[model samples]
Target: MSLKQQLKDAVAKQKKARDITREDIVKNAAAIQRSRQEQKDLSNRPH
Candidate 1:
């Protein structure tokens, strides 16, 4: 491929990787929040 095409492909790949990484971050944050809430709830419950 030409240099221009190669650059375009590289940029596209980078964008895709960034989007996937963003999604993973969001998912992990949500899971961590849920886990924290569960722990808090368990601690507050009567034993």
Candidate 2:
């Protein structure tokens, strides 16, 4: 294989990894938002 082909393959792999990481971050953020909203709801209620 050529050097250029090797570089292209490496770049593609890096991009795929980055995309997966970004997706995980977005999912985690949404979960955190939901948890905070739930906490707020609980605190507003009287015993």
Between which residue pairs do clashes occur in model 1? none
Ten-residue segment with the worst summed lDDT in candidate 1?
1-10
Kindly list the per-residue Cα lDDT of model 2 for residues 1-47, writing each as its tens digit: 99999999999999999999999999999999999999999999998
Query: How many angstroms is residue 12 displaced in model 2 relative to the true structure, after the best TM-score fit?
Result: 0.3
**Best model number under TM-score:** 1
- Per-residue lDDT over 1-47 for candidate 1, one digit per residue giving the tens place of the 0 to 100 score: 99999999999999999999999999999999999999999999999
TM-score of each: 0.97, 0.86
Residue 32 lDDT, candidate 1, scale 0-100 = 100
TM-score of 2: 0.86
